[model samples]
Target: GAPPPPPARAGGWAGAGSPLLSPGEVRSKPMTVLQWEKLSMGKLAHTLWGDGGSDGGAKGAAGALEKLMEPGRAFEIDISALEGRFARPDPSARFRRAESDNSDRSTVGSADGGTPRARISLLEPKRSTSVGIVENKLRGALGGKPLRDAILEVDEALLTQDTLKMALSAVPTTAEQALLLAFQGEPSTLDRPEQLLRSLCGIPRLEGRILAMMFKAQLEPDMDELLQQVDSLKAACEAVQGSAELQALMQIVLHIGNALNAGTARGNAAGFRPSALLKLAEHKAADKKTTLLHYTVEVVQTNAPKVRRVTALLPTLAQASRVSLEELRAKSADLARGMDQVERELTALEEAAEKEEERREALHREAMEAWSAAKEQRDEARRRHREGRAAARASEGGGGGGGGGG
Candidate 1:
């Protein structure tokens, strides 16, 4: 039988060819690649050799591209899997190499394989800070307000592109991919609120949720993954058998894990009611194991430092498992304080409004009373005039009759 359909794609030129076509039949070997050699070296140097001066690690990759593109040579480009390094994991953070000439590009991509991604917050928080400071200074120099607006406009514009759809479509980094994609924009590149949101987003899906949060915020993916990751952590915890911190961590981890099963059947979908994500699991370690409520406090307490520490320190803390009673009380108090202040403000506004309404009613009553009194006076004067005229007419008739003497 004849050879099958040609391969679908090749190195940057997608949809231009088909599969099942051999190198010989396709005539796509290194020989036909010579034309690229004739292109301008300035552009070529940037493309092939890569930037030698900076990011010494990527320099090798660039050089490899240059060698493959050499004229009069036959070759084909393919990659089994691509590896990517992330600078910043925070959504607001950008992937950059100032020294690298190619810093202009949003993400480092391989034509065939996807690029790697990470949250800036997860690694190198210091670098994240320096980038932010530089951007702030630049904006200050350039009249600030317009720069931010302009950047937002650019990002929004890019997000609407059909071609960008291609980049976003590949289930490329299906696992926790949001944080990795955070470092894609530059200072002047953002073009709208959405872009800025996407830029400011941390840990991808989670950060995106916060930036795009509506009144009813929900985290679908993480809620789903919570169970599996917890199970792994729980087993690790039990196996450790020592360290109070470790045990506490395991307790919370198991709590979260149990929540996954307690809800709807998982696997078909990893989703939970916010009620479950918000609360701890039912399982309890009697006496000192702490109730689920206390477990929750332990969780928040443990994670607070972890989020900050994650910026510069190690992934030293995972799942934020320990919450002190005092910390829990403090957090609860703070939450209540916020609600109280809002209530007080609302009450004061309502009282002032009510008073204003009462004053308006009083003024209306006074005006109506005055108007009624004036109308009564006008009516009474008209009645008296009519009566006097009637009396005068009666007297004139009687006098005329007497004078006639009839």
Candidate 2:
């Protein structure tokens, strides 16, 4: 017997049926000693010896066999078990609920905290300055009072251009304004930016005041530019109108043009339009290379050199050419509209301030009248008490005298 085939192991081989040959196949094949040794030297040897080839003795064989014969475990992963262990509910569920509640509240135009929501803000907290800083600056600018009162007291002269620009940037968009208006959340619960915006929203005519201030800040530069353009145009017109040299140059061109057309129907020309000066370049001389303008220049240089100084007007003409009449008109119209808007806003602000003053005065008067009435009533009660006391004393004296006489 070839070592009496090793007793059947609990797991058969390597935790399953033999990897090399099945039990039935081994019985049918009846492998020779050489074939078994060769097979054992490979996978079977490693499996039996636990990766260290057998130590070639009964003791080592017995130990490896004992190790292999032990009960084997198959690792099976149950996906459902994994899911139960690791799955988690959505973390944002509460946030979603709060948002829905806020939406409902907004629609109803009421503030009710059915669910706790994340704080909302117009600007990022980490990237922007704290809302407190912004609020403080605004408070300082608006006279450190309630927004409603501060807006009325805002002084255009006190606001710098940079401040106006910042205010313009912070001006809420229509949708943002609507959102702010709809917000019914507790002010303490809101982020600083939101709270500031909400306070601004409570003021009357806030947008108009900001826009008017911005326009006023820009008005000086706009007026200066407009005046500069006008001055440039005026200088150009004056140069053309008053320059004797330019006038003489034109006269020379006119005389030369008439002499060239002599004997033709175009001869004896007394005058030509100012536009005809441009045609001087179009009329070529007999050589074709020399233009009428070239000829006129040569004649002026040779005969009347003093009139050539008209070239000084070239720069003025160039500057005037760059000035677009239509653009100037458009700018002027825009400035006018801006000024009117500013005036209206200022007038409205003044009237609101006056009305606020009148209301304060009226309240003071009413308070004074009430105080006077209360004082008069108290004085009358004191006078009646004194009179009653005096009459009582007189009756007492009269009674005592009568009793004595009796």
Candidate 3:
């Protein structure tokens, strides 16, 4: 059976004999205390051994289910499977044995198979399950490129040539196109980085291309050229996805830009003021496109007054002639609700004007009464003085003649 265990090497008395005399037949080796529990059968097979197995093979399967049953004993895992490193492959009992045997042979191969040259070929990095394998292969493709060159290559290949032209020119050959339509078809792709890939790849609708460019400009810095391209692209987007919803968003953006930009040289914010544009900010487009339209409508509803105020201020800011619309509208919406409170206060002041007039009349009446009392006292005092002079003259019988004789 299996060549009688290779005829018991040298002095070792082996003949596929089952070790006995132990309490329980001892079966193969005792279970390893490795984190066999963490790795899946496939991981055990791939990372631990080589051969083939989606799920780990027999040993891994036995070990996975048995690790918990095992109480104590150190079991070594694949170096890759060590804490913080490897991803566990899927598990399968059938493949575990084949992979384990492969690992054993690898050890044997290195130890005694042949020359160092043979071992090197056997242990080529590409042939192993190491991430370095692919990393090196990619480097090999670049022919020893520097990091900066690599980035430049990506900008050209991934951005300009690959997407702005190739991918943008036609539908995708992969399922990506279907997925794109499904996502862009609905609104599921906005937040996902992968979904944004369609725009980056230039696989979306015509208008989506401009939005994508805007988003790219937003994400990338100092790319003034690309940002400029966003303007022309905006026109294309408008023409392609020309629905009411998208139009409304467009109107809102222009007004907001104008309000904020008021007098800036950019002149970006003067185009759309709220009053001149709300009716223009249509969300009732006949074509059902889930885009900036739905997003704008939701934003306006959530912060209705802010949207209205931004639209209304558009015209006034435009009058500034050379201000940044961004500057004018910069803080216009921070207190959207406060504008309401200001109107309320003005109304209260108007109503209080009548009550205030009544209080003034009452104060004037009190002052007039005090003045009349003072005048009456002065007149009475004068009358008493005159009478006193007359009485004195009668008693003395010579009031005016006495003074002349003296």
Candidate 4:
């Protein structure tokens, strides 16, 4: 029979006579034996002397030259069998063999008929402190604010494609290869691009579930502390609102202000607004050595030293001022949503694992741990929300009573 369809171009190139095709275009077309022979001869001549060109051009020349040099001689290769000779043994197959043979040195023969991929030892990963200081700083900063919002502010930059690629590169080769194989097939559930990425990166199919657990680990403490800070701020605001000594000092300030403006049109006011407090520092004496607030502080300290306790109560308002209640609640709600999603995914995994014939005990155990941690975080967040609400209600009631008295 006539030479079998010219062997599909190897190294993905077409004849030099044709346009230099891109990688995507190269696979779609094939060259005839005569064309391949001419290209091949040119490639051999170039290689022997110098290609003096790009690598792809040189390879194309080589592939064509290969056909010319072997004219009339049949050449064939069994690609399926190539794996045994060139590729590493499937990790799962090695694991199964290791189990059955009860031997750790499960071997696979190489192209040279030598058992090269045998008794491969697993190595421990090296420890690095690249992000230790940053992690600590993040945890510390989260002491006073919502963590999710803070993380969201920079998560886009931190979790970029480059970062994921670096993370994938760090995974062990066997684990990485196994993960890639598991996701290599078309995904029945995930988007094509996302599945492709997960396949390439060695990320588990249920990584969203795993990632939620990871996030909870990092954020739960911050959630707890933020709730406490919110409560403290509410308590402080309530303290400021309910302090009779503070109210008395305010009355003195109003009286002094009205007396100073006695002859002016703005004199003898029924009450001074709270905003007048901010203007106290702006009012300077003739010598400019003291502010009106300093004088007021002296007067209060001299006549009612007990009222000085108001300064200690100011921290609650100060802390509260730094946080937006609306944004904080939104972050809390987001955490609750994330936990709910994790719970749902865990439920789905459990259901799927139940019907499987294989022993998925390890997968089940991992799912359970993630589920437990997520549930605990959800419970803690719910409890803190309750406490924050009660504190807020108390603060509101105290302010309402104080306002009613005024």
Candidate maximizing TM-score: 2
269-288: candidate 1 lDDT, tens digit per residue: 11122233333434332332
Instruction: List, residue by residue over 1-406, the lDDT tens digit for candidate 4.
Output: 2332232332222221221222222111221110001122233333311232123243332223233322333222222222122233345654432354555566777675433322212222121121222334434445533233333343443443333333323333555345545654455454322233333343333345445554555466758867886887678666654454555455445434443333334444434445677776776543345666776676555444555666775666777777777877887887777787678767876776775635577678888999999999999999999999999999999999998899
Best by lDDT: 2
What lDDT does the true structure give each of the candidates?
A: 0.35, 0.55, 0.34, 0.46
lDDT of 3 by residue, 1-406 (tens): 1221121121111211111112221112111111111222234333211122113343321222223222332211121111112112325422533457655663324355423322221123232223223334434444554322333233443343223332233223346445545553444524232333343334223333322432343334424533444444554433323222222333333322222222233232212222433432332222223322343444345322223333443343333334434633442342333344445544654666667877777777777787778778777777887788877877688666778798
Pairs that collide in candidate 2 are: none
Better of 3 and 4 by lDDT: 4
Error of 4 at 229 (Å): 1.1
Better of 1 and 2 by TM-score: 2
User: Candidate 1, TM-score vs. the true structure?
Assistant: 0.23
Worst 10 residues of 2 by lDDT: 28-37
Query: Would you estimate the TM-scores of all the predictions?
Result: 0.23, 0.46, 0.19, 0.34
Per-structure clash totals for the candidates: 36, 0, 45, 2
Residue pairs that clash (backbone atoms under 3 angstroms), model 4: 40-64, 40-65
